[model samples]
Target chain A: MAKPACKNLEEIFRTPHGAVYQCNRANCFWLEFAGGISAFKASDFLHLKKQVEQIDVPEMVQNTARMADIVILNPFRSERCFVLTVTDVLNLRELLQGAKVMLDLNSMLYDCLHAMAV
Target chain B: MKDLLRLRTSLTEEIETLLNEQIKVEAHSSSVYLAMSSWCNRNGFDNSADYFQKQSGEEREHMLKLFGFINDMGGRAISPEVTNIPQEFESFRAVFETALQQEIYVTQQFNRIADRCFKAKDFMSFQFIQWFLKEQIEEEYIARRALELFDVIGEEGTGRWEIDKQVPKIKYEN
Candidate 1:
């Protein structure tokens, strides 16, 4: 039996700054970051991961401009925005990378279990 | 928990990415054909210009087919941004040579996509791409035949004009 509060949400990965959860009922991922929770569809989540990974940390570090110290992301189909600093970006990257690895592992497990069932 | 990812999309990430890449390839091919059409028209090869226009339209149709299929399967279809289209050609024969090369590249891309679909066990996409694979036979055939026109009719005096006139007649029966 699942916990009552988390009946629909499954924790995929966690870090000190943030964590990733999947809502099986909604078929979306719930991102706990920046003192808020944003829900993203699976494909949107992958796109967001790509956007974050594409951030150039070295450029941000080298540039003396204040704006260069951070990056902004407006996720698709969402009103919420992420304004992340270089440190924040690194943390988020770690969180997302962990979640992606967990997701891949889950997919492999699902395939194996289904193959056995078949 | 239920597999939310699989529930959200029928396409695996790898397959989805590959399909999007193919979409870009098709769009780029369409743009290149359109540029070829323009070059032919500027060079006064009217028949070859029309042929390339028709080919461009067909390539756009192919792009749309892949785009529709991706969306139908609950995957995102990206509208590709095409660049680096050549605006000029060296000579009349060079145009047909480039066209044939483009067709061959497109066939190779479709073959790669089919191979990926097979490996992923996504038989639906594999079956869908079979139409493209078969269409490639006609595409490559027509392009090859048009290029052969330059060889059959030497490009010395009125040879280019004759080749341009016969370009529209090149057909693939099978």
Candidate 2:
């Protein structure tokens, strides 16, 4: 018989100060937290995190899902490590679908910003 | 003179300008590919090097196609100014990544040229550029696929080494 999966959400959410929970499963809920801050502020990362949670439902879980692989918290600033889960890794396939969209969007925004500056 | 002929002449001139820009980009692409080939050869990736060497020839062929088209239109074909190619590469992956980037640049250039010709009502030049636009798609695909293969093999895998061995031996007929 298949073993019932244990709920590890609490362990997954636990993190050291100035750090966040990062997921490592093929596809699961994983994210990092700010070090030294109480775990109560988990709501701050809810923006993109909500999109991932939706994938758990059978009807909501499509063959493809767009999820961030490495969530960089204040990526440009400090040693804020990114978290990724197994589900997030699997979701990368969807993110790559029509992969040119992000690249084209970036170039378009860059051109627009440059034009504005000029 | 008929209004159609006058419009045709004006359209041809516009196409000439766009084609000139395209030829310059092609020249740049050829140089970049040659440099990449040389880097691959030096880094024990002879297959990748040979592949880029062929790619350089292909880009030159693309330039020639534009050159011929401009001459056929009775427009003055300007000499393309190609910049110097960089000699050093940090890794094989970097070389292929650069090639992929160049291919994307070339594809965008071709699209711009084709759009300009279309706007000018120069159907002939637009049709000619259509082939080039299609070619760029394939070029980008090949470059991207090469990079993906490199990723699969890893930076120092025997698979990459074996593929490198096949590089010098493989020769394109055209």
Candidate 3:
């Protein structure tokens, strides 16, 4: 018989990014790291560092910052993976204000989520 | 039993048609946003085009939402047949005004669908339409606000750049 499906969010996080996976059941999480492993690692690390700094920095940094919720786990052997869930895109806008950023990662993340919903 | 079966069949057909029409509307909305994006690009409004491109994605999301709903209900969602979208606009104001009109039309369409579901005693479908009804209100409000901003800038001719600068600040929520 086929193995029982992984249904929990933590079980879903076990699969590494960039691997083809599917969660066919309702209320299950499916992580699709469309980009290759290196890119996913870099983005995930950057987001984690940003989240950590936002949470720990001084009041000056805290005053103009918002951090997205992130879950990090060792999915595959020695491969650290992270997923960021943003409830409010507006909070990101407040965080990025007056900063000279090249690409809008917040918008990209929002689009990625929207694509998944579709 | 025969009469009840006929009534059920008729109700199913009607609901199917309405659902298909909604799919077409969503597709048409995507095309409309694409057209608006192209117009903005040609008119040196890159930020506006970006906004419309995001709007196009949202429209696709709307189509998929309806598609999932229909499939979940054991109903077939027909492929949408979208008309050619006009790519030219006289001004930004005109574009937004047209968008506002389309949102109003879509709200009316949703209301009609809700009414039909009520008549058919399909409370589930009627309840599902409530989300779209609420969304339409915000959609119209945004378009109307854009129109009002256009009027304000057009009247003064001084704040156009400022308004254009603000375009990039618009937020897109998933």
Best by TM-score: 1
Lowest lDDT block of 10, candidate 3 chain A: A95-104
Which candidate comes out best when scored by DockQ?
Answer: 1
iRMS per model in Å: 1.6, 29.2, 24.4
On residues A1-118, what C-alpha lDDT tens digit does candidate 3 reach at each position?
1223454212212222222222233322222342323212222322332443344224433354444243233433225444433322223223222110212233345547779999
CA lDDT of every candidate: 0.88, 0.58, 0.59
- Among all windows of 10 consecutive residues in model 2 chain B, the one with the lowest summed lDDT is B1-10
Off by over 4 Å in 2: A1-118, B1-11, B163-174
Model 1 chain B weakest 10-residue run by lDDT: B1-10
Q: Mark the regions of model 3 whose C-alpha exceeds 4 Å error after superposition.
A: A1-118, B1-11, B155-158, B168-174
> Across residues B70-122, which tens digit of lDDT does each residue of candidate 1 receive?
89998889999888988888888888899899999999989998999999888
On DockQ, the stronger of 1 and 2 is 1
Write candidate 1's Cα lDDT for A12-115 as tens digits: 99888888998887888988887878889888998899799999999999999988988999998877799999999999999998998898788779999999
DockQ of 1: 0.59
Question: lDDT ranking from best to worst?
Answer: 1, 3, 2
TM-score of 1: 0.90
